[model samples]
Target: MSKNTQAPIPDSYPMTGGDGDYSYSRNSFYQRAGSEVAKSIVDNAIQENLDIKTISSSVSRNSFYIADFGCSVGPNTFTVVQNIIDAVQKKYQSDGLSSQVPEFEVFFNDHASNDFNTLFASLPPPRQYFAAGVPGSFHGRLFPESTLHIAYSSFSIQWLSKVPEELFDRNSMAWNKGRIYLTNAPNEVSEAYAAQFAKDMKNFLDARSKELVAGGLMVLTALSTPNEIYHFPVSPEFMFDLLGSSLMDMVKDGIISEEQVDEFNLPVFLASPEDMRRCIEKNGCFIIERMELLIPLSSINAQACAMNIRASVEGLISKHFGSEIIDELFGRFQKKLEESINLVEEIMTKRRNQLVTVLKRK
Candidate 1:
């Protein structure tokens, strides 16, 4: 086995309650917006033939192996697969190769901790595709060498591993007993996060290079920032601090253990275009095909956001605010959303464009 040295796993992950625990699937805001974004990526790849290679004679049609990395359960994956099929069919028709449909092998991969039972149960009727559990991180190789033709990962890979133990020293009072980095994390925190991202991205590419044949295409869509700020979305420090404060409040009130919070790592990071470009260059086998910035509309409204939050954070809320406070928490969050809708609209108008990139392996 290849030696792996990522961050430690968080306790809050591998969430309990199975499929029901992640009610985000049911939220229309998340589903619809995600589906639209995914469709655009697939369509762009096919039209551009991002992996086309020059031939001395006639161009040989290559077998297409498509994998949806970090594919979670439910309609999002299905919708993307359908769009890919449509794009392929359109390409074949345009090329005047109507005798047969191209052979495609589709794979759905997520963390082993994901609810495979729920995911597999909801899959579409089986055809010429295979489903396998990929337990390790996508930043590492999950398949054999040069076997992939196309790869896609959406809204995943943002979560970092739990903070490494080395970040804390025994004498640090800022340490919340492993609950979080000292309230005032050392200046190295920013560099540490960026370094991890660079390493993870490099691993992702190195693995992909080995798994993807020459002239393979990959379309990657993830959350990114516009400028080179230490924090993603122009407020990385603020967001982490806010979430840390929330988690710490729960710990102070005896809702969750300090160790538990320490173990829980948020799966979100904002990458700027420069960061993305640098990672691509480091990979050494991919060339940029297309890039765009977009902000998708939420599938759910304020009401549904409230519900998903309740389902996701209810346990934490109950621990801190007591079971009875659940309803109140939801109400307050929703009210805040409603009140800030105008401000959100204004801010988003300026930042609606997020980043999307299409890359081809050399």
Candidate 2:
């Protein structure tokens, strides 16, 4: 079925995985890094009875419905879904209703153009939930009203619905000429990105509020900047800066046109807690039960980090610049990153924070 809003997103490149020659499936250390955060959320939700008490006897032969929005290719997804289901079962056991445990239905959602075939093929066996794929953008309605009990998104909400149109208009004050994201950009450029994020986030909250049952739970983990800072020290924006610099290097080498760099921009934003809270409060359908920021403690090797970043964005770069230059570009990226190991290590130690929030349907 079609989503309520058919927005035009640059769908040419998804993260490198599944159908893409570069496998995010193989290089997804970032997803793995996020699994512990997701598991912790499920555990806390269970402790707080986030969705357990919401299960109504109104629906006969009740089944627990859980969804993972922006569920990329497998591996980490399997782990997270399993953790949630296990928590639910434990809750039932504690209530002495183990035998009456409801059937489970797990939905994996992402862009319609996502690699569903690869996602399904890699599903782990001895499944506790009846899994299904709901192909649509989460920024709009994807399910029937009040049908979902739990909705979870991990490291995914950072992506905006689309690049702001102002970024492309040469006459506009927000024209981001050399860079893709808002980092080091002018106030107008930052404002354009923020506006896009606000619009997309409002749509996201509104849609989810409609889909979730009363007292249903929504947990989201996303990249975030601190309250006082406009930019995250260890954000993908930094990587974009590096990529942008690398692209400029190629421009100097006469490898790619400068016009191409001028035309390209990523459709993603890292939100601040204040912005997130404001959006949630503005929606008025959900109450924030818990919010916390988590930073990865262990630092990954520079080369490994570069590969992980490549797996997540190589498709985007390759789509703009020909695939032929992929190796050269990333090779340059790795060397550039490696040379600054001390700085990268420092950033990784403090790292950007992941804003983990649990909201209860009002």
Candidate 3:
């Protein structure tokens, strides 16, 4: 890979591991809820769009392969993969191929430092599918060519492979100074982030295209900022609004250096449906079969939402800002979040932009 597309560092630590209260497995209920909400849409997509007969017959008659990309140590990945397996079985039975139902193998993928031990230990027993853990950034290929029948990812892929290198160079126009996120960022900074997202997502699609057999299907569900919304301010990942402010507050108090603030930026990019469509079309390996948006986090309260963010980003934050400040930073975050509940309540009711897109490999 070129310098522009360099590999993500091995220690780009994933969600907090283990099954403890703060672990991603325990704190990621909102993502699991998203999987539940997306279940119907994914199942419908499989029944309506996945060329099951063609893929299974042409690819493998006795085994079906599925891969979950960007599968953190969280538990929701298990649910989403199971949903796909059940849906595929139903599709086969519906098409009078029940007798030929293939054995299922699922590949759970994530960053190399992800707690694969915990993920594997928590795997539900007597599962229908055989499970394997794959550790790597999903920006590039992990599996062999033309092997996967269905590729599923839920509430993932918003993460770029790494923070844009330009953001760290003071000489670069995109240097994000005094801010930790894209919200409230200048247009140039946001464009830099978007350019990196385009690169990461295109690499993702290209890799999946190579791994998926011809006529294979991919079901992807992710948090999206609709084209109409300037910044997706309502969701739990208001890392930009909530956590960034907390950091800046500390900066104002002289707890951390201004240069430290200038040097840091989250590697997440919340793309719109239009953005996803553009990237998919540009890759030219897959065609969108269905793209729709939904809102699913209304029931989660402020405190719960804060826990979700902490679980997802605590490792990354500690890596950059040291573990000593973690508690203080997130405490301010919770307080600010509770204080802003009214605005959040208003925005929650208005936006419906959790993007669920199903793609077919051409």
Q: Best-fitting candidate, measured by TM-score?
A: 3
- Candidates 1 and 2 compared: the better one by TM-score is 2
The per-prediction tally of clashing pairs is 14, 0, 0
Ranking by TM-score: 3, 2, 1
Candidate 1 structure quality by residue, lDDT tens digits, 1-362? 11222234442333222455335456434434645865766686776764333210112264556788877665577677767767866766666665555566678887676666777787777545555556666777888877776787776655444443333333333223443432245545545556667777888888888887666778777766666543432322232444465556656777557655654444344677788889999778888887777766533244655554454445544544356645644565566546655544433344643567788878
Best by lDDT: 3
Q: List the residue pairs that clash in candidate 2.
A: none
Model 2, 1-362: lDDT tens digits are 12222222475345666745458788877667766855776687766755455556422367888999988887777888888888878878887778878888999998877788899999997887899999988899999988888898987888887888878777778777877677788888888888888999999999999998888888898877766364844654676677778888988999988777777788888888888998999899998988887765477677787888788777777777779988998888888888877767766557656788889888
TM-score of 2: 0.93
Residue 158, candidate 3: alpha-carbon lDDT: 86
The models' CA-based lDDT, in order, is 0.59, 0.79, 0.81
Clashing pairs in 3: none
Give model 3's TM-score versus the native structure. Answer: 0.94
Which ranges of candidate 1 are over 4 A from the true structure?
Answer: 1-8, 11-22, 51-63, 126-133, 161-187, 230-242, 248-267, 298-303, 306-350
Q: Give each model a TM-score.
A: 0.76, 0.93, 0.94
**Worst lDDT window (10 residues) for model 3?**
1-10
